[model samples]
Target: DAGITQSPRHKVTETGTPVTLRCHQTENHRYMYWYRQDPGHGLRLIHYSYGVKDTDKGEVSDGYSVSRSKTEDFLLTLESATSSQTSVYFCAISRDRGTGELFFGEGSRLTVL
Candidate 1:
């Protein structure tokens, strides 16, 4: 098993409130990424970290931000949520970047009103 999990498997929130999603892994891998899946858009990256305290932004990182303070935990924060941001978020990890073979968590369903 890849040993990754996403929290708040389901969620519903107001349009303008802040929401935070958590990803936990037991694999001790160095690469962790946050992505959101929307209809017709495929998976879009929000943020990713190579190692603890080492992070970088992804293509669709406007309303989202992330932090990785520990090897096994990465957190994604929506500063001010929006209806457009309503999507299923997934956390993924890879043992190596060259292979591009990613293992994804079940996903977090977020509904915005």
Candidate 2:
């Protein structure tokens, strides 16, 4: 289970509406990332946090924002979601630099209409 949990596993929202997906981890991992998976794009990074209150933007972060205020919680927000943002969002946790392997959450499916 990786001790990771994503909230609102499925969501449907109208265009221009606000949406927020939560990722909660019990393993106390030091690194966390948010990614969106699509048919052709595969998985694109949205944002990532290395520690509490330390976040960085990634390739597909144009319409998204993220916050990490605690070691166990990371929040990804879409201030104004659009249909183009509809995808399966995944949260991944890594305890090491690149060898410990990543632990992924079930996923949050967001549909914007």
Candidate 3:
């Protein structure tokens, strides 16, 4: 395996609740990303980090936020879960600098009721 992974391959949550998913990587790479995949739409970036405690919002960062306090750990938090938020979440990383090509995790399925 390269060095990236996501946890809780499957999750079910109630509407308006808060949920947090974990992404762990051993690569120690400088870049980490979170993307959500939904039918008909391409993967949308939720957030990303350049280094420990260095992060920023991405295109679809509204209801989601992220934190990276360690080089090997990045956490994504869904402030208020909704049915619309149900989708497959993927954690990605790049061993190289910003070339845009990313390594993806298997994916985490989240279902909100």
lDDT of 3 by residue, 8-108 (tens): 88999999999999999887788989999999999999999989899999899988989999988889999999888999999999876557878888999
lDDT of 2 by residue, 65-111 (tens): 99999999999999999999999999999997579488999999999
How much lDDT does each candidate structure score?
0.94, 0.94, 0.90
Clashing pairs in 3: none
Q: What ranking of all candidate models by TM-score puts the best one first?
A: 1, 2, 3
The weakest ten consecutive residues by lDDT in model 3 span 94-103
| Higher-ranked by TM-score: 1 or 3 | 1
Clashing pairs in 2: none
lDDT of 3: 0.90
The number of the candidate with the highest TM-score is 1
- What's model 2's lDDT at 3? 96
Greater TM-score among 2 and 3 belongs to 2
Location of the lowest summed lDDT over 10 successive residues in candidate 2: 95-104
